[model samples]
Target: MRIAIFTDTFLPQINGVARTIGRLADTLTRNNIPCVVITPETKFQGQRNYELLVSPGLSLPFYPECLLSIPNYTETFQKLNSFKPDLIHVATEFSMGICGLKYASTTGLPIVSSYHTNFPQYLSYYKVEIIAMLAWKYLRWFHNMCLKSYCPSKSTLKLLKQQGIKNLEIWGRGVDTELYNPAKFDFSFRKRFGQNKKLLLYVGRLAPEKDIDILMKSFQMLNKKHRNSHLVIVGDGPLRQKLEQSAPPNVTFTGYLHGDELSRAYASSDIFVFPSTTETYGNVVLEAMSSGLPVVAAFSGGVRENLVNRINGLACSPRNVMDMVTAMERLITDETLRKELSLQARDHAMTKSWDTIFNKLILSYQEIVCLHNKVTA
Candidate 1:
C-alpha cells in the first residue's frame, strides 16, 4: 500500500514529531510500502527518497528549529495525486497539514490526524494566554473532519475527549529496544563528565513550554548532602542559554546528541528526570525505561499513564519541586531499590515495540478507508 504523510517538520529537524514520523516512513519502506513524506525542505543531502516531497517554509519564531511551512496546496495536491496514496496521514496543525486536509476534503479521501503537542499550553508559556481558547477551537474543528484522530497515549486521548474532540484513538510511540538498552551502559560516560556521583539525566527540547525551570530548580533542591549528584541535560531549545545561566556547578549541558551516543547517555544515568508537564506522550521516558534507567516524571499526561508508582518509575506532582527532590533522593539513597525499579522499567519498555504500533495503525487506516468508501458510495 502507498501512504502519504504530511507534517510541518521532518528530517534535519531533531524534535520528537519529526523523528517519530521518520521512523514510521522507514518502517513502511522496509515492508515494501511506498510512503511519501510531505514536509518543509531543509539542508537535505545524501540518497534522497523519491517519495519524500518538500515545500517552502519560514522558521518558527519561538521554535526556530521547527519550520512553519509555506504550503502551496495546488502543487502539493498535484504531487499527491500523482503518487495516489491509499489515504493521507496529517501529523501537524500547520500550513502543510492544512494543505493535506484541504486536499483530502476536495478529493473525498480518507485522512487521519495525530495530536502531538499541546500548543495551547505552549502558548501559555509564551505569554499568549488569550489565544488558548481560539487554538482549541481551531484544533477541535480541524481534527473532527478526520476519519480517526490518534493520540500518543491513553491519558492524552482522555484529555482530547474532555476537550470535546471526536473519533479519538490511541497511537502510542515506541523506542528502539536494541538501540536503547541496558547493554549500552559504559563507564566512559562517568569518565567524560567527571561524574563520581549518581547521574540525573533530562532529555528533550529545552524550552519554556517544557517546564524546564522546574527541573532546574529541582536540581538545585538536591541538598548539600547530594552535591556529588550531577545533572547531564541533553537536547537544545529556546531556553538553553537561560537554563545554562541559572544551572548549578554540578549541571552539565551536552547541547544535543543522536544515535548511539544518545543511547549511552540514557543507559549510563542512574535516574531519568523529566519534569515537562507539556508532553502529550513522554517518548524520552520510554527510551530511558528501555535503557533500564528509572524515570521520575510529572504525574500528568502520558507519563503518568505508563508509570506505576514505585514500580517501573515514580510519578510526582507536576511542577512540585519538593516532590521531585524527594523522588530523586529515594533513587539516590537506595541502590537496591533503584536496581529493582530499573529492571521493571526495562520490562515495561520491552512490551512497547514500534512494529506492533505500526501494524495496528495500518489496520486502522484500512478500516477508516473502507468505512469512508461505503459512506461515500
Candidate 2:
C-alpha cells in the first residue's frame, strides 16, 4: 500500500524523529511500497529513495534546527491527489503535520500519528511553563482525530492516555546492530578524542530540554575523582556555544557525526551518559548499547523503558547531579561491572532489529487502510 508521511523534521536534521522517518522511508522502499515524504525545504541536500515534496518554511526561534513549514494548500492537494496514498502518517505536531491532517480530513483517508517529542515537558526547560496546559490541550485535540496515535514507549503511551488521547499504540524504535556493533571500535578514534583516557560519551542535541546542565555538572563531579576520564559531547544545538564556553577541561565537543563516524564514536567510548528526561525514546541510548557501551541515564520518561538498573545500564534520578556522578563513577571504577553491562547492552540491542520493527509498522498501516476502506464502502 502507498503511504504519505508528514513531518516537520527529516534527513540532514540529525534528530531522533528525522532519523526515524528516514529509516521508515528506506524500509518502505525496500518493501516495494510507494511512499511520499512531505517536509519543509532544508538547506542540506540528502539522498533518499522516495518522493520528497518540499514546502517553504522558516526556522523556529528557540529550536533553529527545525523548520516550521508553511505549505501551499493548492500545491499540497495536487501532489496528494496524484500520489493517492492509502495511509497518511503524521510524524510531528507542527505545521507539516497539520497539513497532513487537513488533507486526510478532506480526502477521507486513513490517518495515523506518532508522538515523538515531549513538547509540553520541554516548555518548562525554556521557562515557558505557562503555556503547558494549552499545549497539552492542543495535543489532545490533534491526536484524537487520528485512527491511532503511536507512542515510542509504554511511558509515553501512559502520558498521552492521561492527557485524554485515545487509540494509542506502542511503536518502539530499533537500532542497526551491524553498523553500531562493537566491531566498529577504533583505538585511533579513542586516542584522538579521549587522549588515552576512559571516554564518556553523550550523543544528542545540546539543548535546554536535554538537561545538558545536569550532564555538565555531573561530568565535572565525576572528573574531580577520576581525572583520567574524558567526556565527549556529540551533536550540536542553540546551546553549543554557551556549553563549550563553560565546559570543563578534557571535555570535547564533536559537533555532529553520522554514518560510520558516529558508530565509531559510540563503539570507541567506554560509557554512555545521558541526562535528558524529555526523550520519547532514547535512540542514542540504544545506539550506545548496540555499540557495547554501558549506559548511565536518567530514570524518567521513556528512558526507563530501556535502561534497567544494574543490568544493561544504570538509571539515575532525573536532574540530580550527585546521583548521575555516582553512577558514572561506578562504571568508571569497576571494569567488571562495565564489561558485564556492555555484553548485556549489546545482547539487548541485537534483539531489536530495524527490519522487524518497520515490518510490524507496515502491518499496522495495512490494517488501518483495510478498516477505513470497509467503513467507506
Which residue segments of model 2 deviate by more than 4 Å? 43-46
lDDT of 2: 0.92
Instruction: Pick the lDDT winner.
Output: 2
Q: Provide the global lDDT of candidate 1 against the true structure.
A: 0.87
- The digit string of per-residue lDDT tens for model 1 on 1-377 reads 67899888887788888888888888887878788988898665535454778888898998776688877777878888899987889999888889889888898788999999888888989999999899999999989978789999888898899888999999988889999999998898877767478899999998898889888888888856598799999999988898888788889999899889999999988999999898888889999999999989898887875788899988899899999999999999999999999999999999988999999988888788788778878
Which tens-of-lDDT digit does each residue in 82-197 have in candidate 2? 99999999999999999999999999899999999999998988899999999999999999999999999999999999999999999999999999999999889987855669
- Listed in order, each prediction's TM-score against the native is 0.96, 0.98
Q: Report how far residue 129 has shifted in candidate 1, in Å.
A: 1.3
